[model samples]
Target: MINKMQILSLTALGNLDAYIRYANSWPMLSAEEEKLLAERLYYNGDLDAAKTLILSHLRFVIHISRNYSGYGLPQADLIQEGNIGLMKSIRRFNPEVGVRLVSFAVHWIKSEIHEYVLRNWRIVKVATTKSQRKLFFNLRKTKQRLGWFNENELRIVAQELGVCSEDVREMECRMSAQDISFNPFPDDESSDRKLTTVMTHLRDNTSDFANGVEEDNWEMHATNKLTNALRILDKRSRHIIRARWLNENNKITLQEIANGYGISAERVRQLEKNAMKKLRTAIEA
Candidate 1:
């Protein structure tokens, strides 16, 4: 156990094997040695004491990092995170506490690694709430089979984790869901199988070429019917129909049309009713 931070000669972890070898080369600190270092750092703020403590405990960080390899994240990154947690514990460790540095550092080390796994395990975060987050970390280990859980398995897992079955099921579904690309690559060999892309086939209701053509054809056919129907009416009736119904911006009212035709407004209204009935019949036919 060690309880101090030291700036090691290690600059980067680009060469993972070399970094691991270097980290493991440091021997573990004995109990007396750790106590002396902790006292020196705590009382006198001795930087050298901190250095020795951190160097001697580098292997512990490595040992703890190996457990998180199941998350599919890079091992070097996990080791780096665990190393941070170890340093954090060293900063807060008190020699008077009577606990081994390794024992005290374990929680901090696992905490950093857990955060890393949650962040990088999936593109979308699988865990949000505290219960879901707890279930997420423990659920993977509880699961024995490869596929989804049966009711028995789900209930067992929920009971073991002390959570509701619904939470377990939700976390399981989240874990099993795959993140997909929004726009698939055209050159990809498997693009055909992954046809679930927005760019490929999402319906654009605002710009439907087939729908636009159909609508235009229907409008033209209706216009031709109305024009033929108007030709069947007398000239006065056609004028009255156009003024009353077809003119969009300046629709002539019944009284206005009546004034233009030198007839009562009621006469114009009767003519409009008769003309609309005829147009409806002709269009239907």
Candidate 2:
């Protein structure tokens, strides 16, 4: 277990035999040896003592992580989580509790592995309630073979597990189901199958392309009419309209235009209003 993390980093796990040979090399600690190491680390804050305690316990972490292999997860990942749990247990272990570190560490190890399994088991979570969570970890143990349970088997499992048959059936369905992509790739093998994905055939009717194009054309035509209409205004009013509304990058206040023309701001505003009325009438015509 001590060499497990280093081996993971420095070598390929693609070859199974070499990996097994490495796991076999770490020495197991006797009860007396483990307790002494635990005491040294707990009482004196000895760094080497803590390392020895952790290193010696890595084999057990591997042993526990292996039990979770049925969930179709990577075995190395499970062992890594269990190792984390073991470190936590070492940090919290009380030598005065009169239990060996391995005996006490089992809960912490299994708990970390349980969390990992639940999170990765499905794209959508199969178990959220307390009863369902209990079933997630222990449900497989109740199964004797492959495929769905018959009526009698469902009743038996439900009674033994203290859950209803409906819950069992629901969980089984969730377990059997696979994740689907909402928007399939263009390179998907079958055009017909790709069309079956939810997003492929759906349309947003509110923003229909033909209606959008017609509205855009009408708007452009109205803009051309307005531009021609502005030609009817005198220079001063035309300048006011362009400054006040058209040129977003360089707009001027009525007072600024009034200062340039040597008129009151009120007079400039009246001219601006008259220009708009004439432009509207011209555009309508």
Most lDDT-accurate candidate:
1
**What TM-score, computed on C-alpha atoms, does each candidate reach?**
0.62, 0.60
Residue 135, candidate 2: how far off, in angstroms?
A: 0.6
Residue by residue across 172-226, what tens digits does model 1's lDDT show? 8999899877765575766566434665666777887988899999999989998
Reference-based TM-score, model 2: 0.60
Clashes of each: 0, 0
Off by over 4 Å in 1: 1-11, 145-147, 186-285
lDDT of 2 by residue, 155-273 (tens): 88888888899988887778778987775556566565534556766788777798889999999999999999999899999999999999999998999999999999999999999
The count of residue-pair clashes in candidate 2 stands at 0
Worst 10 residues of 1 by lDDT: 2-11
Model 2 error, position 124 (Å): 1.5
Candidate 2: what lDDT? Answer: 0.80
